[model samples]
Target: MKYEKAQEILPQDLINKIQEFMDGGYLYIPKAETNKRSWGDSTGIKKELNNRNNNIYKDFESGMKVDELSNKYYLVENSIRRILREHKKSNK
Candidate 1:
């Protein structure tokens, strides 16, 4: 999200009313529900995590130890285990 000058875009009356209520403040305007994206939709983080988890599964199938995977992926052992468990559950 970017800060846009309300004075430049909004009607003068609306801006005046807003200024009357709060001077020199931030106003949060949310997108319409129809325009909203789900989490990670715009950033590609979801795709990246999926790719990492798939690689984790492949590494485990190739006999990678949990601790080794944790070290290689920079994740904790428990996180690696959880990823493996999630993969298993999803496969079923």
Candidate 2:
């Protein structure tokens, strides 16, 4: 986001109509609902996290201990357990 002056974009008549309700304060307009993107859609972090969780679940299935996974991923034991649980739930 960038702040754009109304005069630069909106027509004078439209600005006047808007001014009737608001004197000079800034107004925010949001993007259309259908055009909105979910968090991490642009950065690919969501995908990366999903892949990592999948690997963790697979490792656990292959006899890897929760403590070992916690150390390998630098996460708390509870977080590793939670990720495993989430994977199991999603598979169903």
Candidate 3:
């Protein structure tokens, strides 16, 4: 989000009221609760990571070691382990 001048957007009375509480600081106006999007939902990052984790599990099942998967995916060993564990739990 970009900063818009209060004078340009807010009514004079509203600006004055805001200034009374905060002299010249930034004010954040959040999006409505109904309009909120979860992290990565709009960017498709969640989908990408899901695909990646699925591939990782496939490779693990096909006899690829955790360390090898980590190196191939450029993730840490612990992250690979967590992914495998989560996949196992999901399968169960």
Candidate 4:
């Protein structure tokens, strides 16, 4: 799937809603069904983390070890390893 930046894909209405949340002193965006899915949830940190993990796994499968990739990407090797471990356990 091709990823588009949030500023490009988010409609004006959604942008307004996000601004409202921010203005109201809310650091986290509230989950709301703007279309078929919750906009806030779809663009959240959890989704970003999952995407990073998938990319890491792909690199690992292509002959890059966890430590090497983690060093190159400036990510914590142990954290990436744990994420891979949990992902494997969940798929079992």
lDDT (Cα, tens digit) per residue for candidate 2, span 3-22: 99999999999999999999
Off by over 4 Å in 4: 1-43
Task: Give all TM-scores, in the order shown.
Answer: 0.79, 0.89, 0.85, 0.49
Candidate ranking (lDDT, best to worst): 1, 3, 2, 4
- Over the stretch 13-90, how does candidate 4's per-residue lDDT look in tens digits? 887888765653424434466545644476797788778877777787789988898896688989878877877777
Clashing pairs for predicted structure model 4, backbone only: none
TM-score of model 1 relative to the true fold?
Answer: 0.79
- Candidate 4 matches the true fold with a TM-score of 0.49
Cα displacement (Å) at residue 24, model 1:
4.4
**Which ten contiguous residues of candidate 1 have the minimum total lDDT?**
1-10
**Each candidate: what lDDT?**
0.96, 0.95, 0.96, 0.73
Single out the weakest 10-residue window by summed lDDT for candidate 3. Answer: 1-10
Q: Lowest summed-lDDT stretch of 10 residues in model 4? A: 22-31
**Cα RMSD for candidates in order:** 2.0, 1.2, 1.5, 10.8
19, model 3: CA deviation in Å? 1.9
What TM-score does model 3 achieve against the real structure? Answer: 0.85
Kindly report which residue pairs in candidate 1 clash with one another. none
Instruction: Choose 3 or 4, whichever is better by lDDT.
Output: 3
Local accuracy of candidate 1 as per-residue lDDT tens digits, 6-90? 9889999999899999989999999999999999989999999999999999999999999999999999999999999999999
